[model samples]
Target: MYECAVLSVYVDLALGLAVTFLLLSLLVSGLNEAFVRLLSIRSKFLWAYLRDTLDGADDRTGAWLPAGVLDVFRVLPFLRDPRPRHSDRPAPAQPSAVPDPGERAGDSMINLLYERVREIDHGKRGRTSISDIPPARFAVAVMELVTAGGDVDDFLTRLRQIDSPLYGPLKGVWESAQRDLDRFTKGVETWFDGEMQRLSTLYKRYVTWVVAVLGVVVTLLFSMDGLEYAKTLLRDNAYRASVTAVAEAGPEAYAELRARCAGQEPVACVTETLSQPALVGMLDQALVSLSIPDQGAPSVHWNGGRWWDRVTTPAHWPGFLLTYVALLFGAPFWWDVLRRITGIKAKR
Candidate 1:
């Protein structure tokens, strides 16, 4: 009975992930197209508008006003992180907070002018240059992305072996980023906004939601054995074998019917139940059994969800893995913030 309850939880989590994955898979192709459209207008317009509004000193350089405007904020260093013995992690500094947006132009102009002098003297040394042509940075970013092969292990392994002069500077920048990120997390612990005089439950929704997610994580961690049980049961049960068989067989019978789903109607039908990958995979397996190998170009990598089976499933079991990974990420950030704000000295 105890094991049954645990199995139920495993079932629910798998179901939840399956539901999320299915919906994502169904909408993914359309979402990709929508994203392309969104970027076409918003990305460029936002940049140009921000640039023009922030800097108007005859347009010799890009926006200076924005930098100056940022300086107007009554921001203070809520946390003092340990300065790295040798890293260019900018010492976190505070600026005055902006109470209103109306005085931005006049206030920002002077601030920008002041910042211009400081930057001219203290800009990052290894900054990449840009010309009218598309910057090589994007190419480099793509190379990094592609060479990593979408795996963390491969990315880190290759990073250590990189012998290029270009890589040495990037390595330093990466280390500094790690330091800054550590400080940011540390600052968050005691960080308070002028807007919130007291940290009410309502004011701490971000922290609260994170805690709730942690509860979900704890539940999953305790259910790991149950998850393995579910997989094993699914593999061995002859009653479940019928379900898998139906999914694997008789593709032509369902394929024509599914094809008639003009829009996302077929996938959308199970939008509440199936995650994209499970539904898509189930459908595809049935189709192939009916001797219909799909010639359709695969969906976006993020959406298709097949990559999970190919990549993650091979390395580890399925069901809500990245969710835990994300929480792991947030843990460090929150811990750092707390440490900085509370001035918790780390044990050596």
Candidate 2:
């Protein structure tokens, strides 16, 4: 009977910890999403990939393609500024002398292909740039641009005229296609898919650092001392039981919150979910139960003491680090773990 009682306590403690981590994970994820959107990180990476692929150089200097090609690409009809120009402002004067079309045919062709691939939608709010383009659409756009209102023969001839680093690979794709337009389009699609896969890998690597920073910030802000919290859960029967009860009902609560937050922006969704009376009450109880003296202060505080002692709280560092690392695993992962733990508890 004593062993069974101890097992029950341990299970309840695990449930409480799982619930805490799950909630923290959700907050971190929503904040991270909002930050990513605000900074346009995905859009920037997409632009960098496009620039590197089209110009054969990631930098603005343009190793194979001419400088300013990416700038011109950004100004294409489908990609130009989205904000409406003020009607009161005078229109810019057009130059009388036109430059030779041959001078910028390569740049123009690249821009045309991009414009076709990602045509602007009239219904949605206008966006200056896009974060993604379908590989199949990109392939079709390339074929259409090279054909130039002519047949497959024109596409073949124009393909040869491509003066950039893309010429050699495109030629290989052409040969693999046996000069068939459909086969050529499929080859291009495959090529673009491979490049996009690489881009996705690079984006994940970059986002990892961003997530780490956000995790540290969140850990410090909440004073989440994982070790201290665990110790409290082990010692305090009433608190553990209360938190475990909440954890047992967590799935239904999460489902309701998810339904309430559907279609909302990440920041707004987090705000709305956290503002729920039940959630607020739970968090209040948790704050008191956890014995966190200053509700809003970070782990490191300016206590009224000597300058060195005031800001030095090395004791919380290990727990803070552990919490930060856990947060970096992301919300979906914690949610899955929470579900599994809940299932385990049910089985017992």
Candidate 3:
């Protein structure tokens, strides 16, 4: 027969770990995003491909069209800036938040190419530039950018100059569409769609690696001796009970927090909640209940020796494994598990 009290304690311990992993996931995600932006990997790849595709002839002057295609959000006004707006005036330093620039921009390289092509074909249509070009008309815009009253041979010559390794796979696609100018633009768009999908896969893998690295760093910073923490959770009845209460209360609190951040779709809610003081306080409270240190403490008790001990101790393996590896699954998985477990507990 299983002891009901022991089961309840274990359940709570699991929930507490879930909460910890969720918070770590958020932190990891934010750091990874910053890292990606700092390197400008996505934008660089996008711009490089656009430049190579449009100015493949190495014609710096003719590359104007591809060089001017702006970012999607900047081009489309109705889409709106999903992030919160802040004033230009300096404010008190707070949690790390990405800088948000409100609406104001010029043509992206693609849009620039569109504008130049449109100018050559029909002259100024109005005050509007290629940034205002609709998605459906993108292929049309590309066709104009490439042809612009020129022969198919000239168009192919410009495209041939794009020898970048990233464009290697699309070479065949481009070659097939070259003979037919009308189909060329459509083919290019199709190729771009495929490349975007590839990029999406690549980025997800990068984010996963970043999350794992950050997880380890976070655990170390907290002096989170997984083995000792596990022992406390299992042996100290009062501590386990307190952590269990917090775990039971967490989901409802999280739901309320999500409601408060109600804005655009998924991303807006996540960003807003992450920046909120209430959410931070709740996480801090939960961490305290679980006897986890968040910020660095003055005492040097939890140093290299404790870390070494945790790694060597056979008994601590379960808790250590959970703490280190849980983050690889990401926060959503753990949250889902917590919800299912709580639901079962409630039913009983």
Strongest candidate by lDDT: 2
* Model 2 lDDT, residue 304, Cα: 36
For residues 1-348, write the lDDT of model 3, one tens digit per residue. Answer: 349877877786776656666777667667767865554444434443454443342333333112222432122122221111222323222211111123212222334343433432221222212122233355555455444526545444433343323234335655787656556666766766765665456445545665777777665444354555545445444533544554588766555434544644434555443344322332232222232244665332324554555446677556556667766777667767878877744335
lDDT of 1 at 166: 24
lDDT by residue for model 2 over 126-214, one digit each (tens)? 33246677888778666655655466555544444544455566777888999887898999999989988977876676567667777
Per-residue lDDT tens digits for candidate 1, residues 39-141, read: 3322222222223322332234433222332221111111111111122333223322221334444324223222222222221222211111122322233
Candidate 2 lDDT score relative to the true structure: 0.57
Q: Model 1: which ten-residue window has the lowest total lDDT?
A: 75-84
The TM-scores, one per candidate, come to 0.20, 0.64, 0.50
Ranking by lDDT: 2, 3, 1
Greater lDDT among 2 and 3 belongs to 2
Candidate 2: residue pairs that collide: none
Deviating ranges (above 4 Å) for candidate 1: 1-239, 243-348
Candidates 1 and 2: which is better by TM-score? 2
In model 1, the number of clashes is: 17
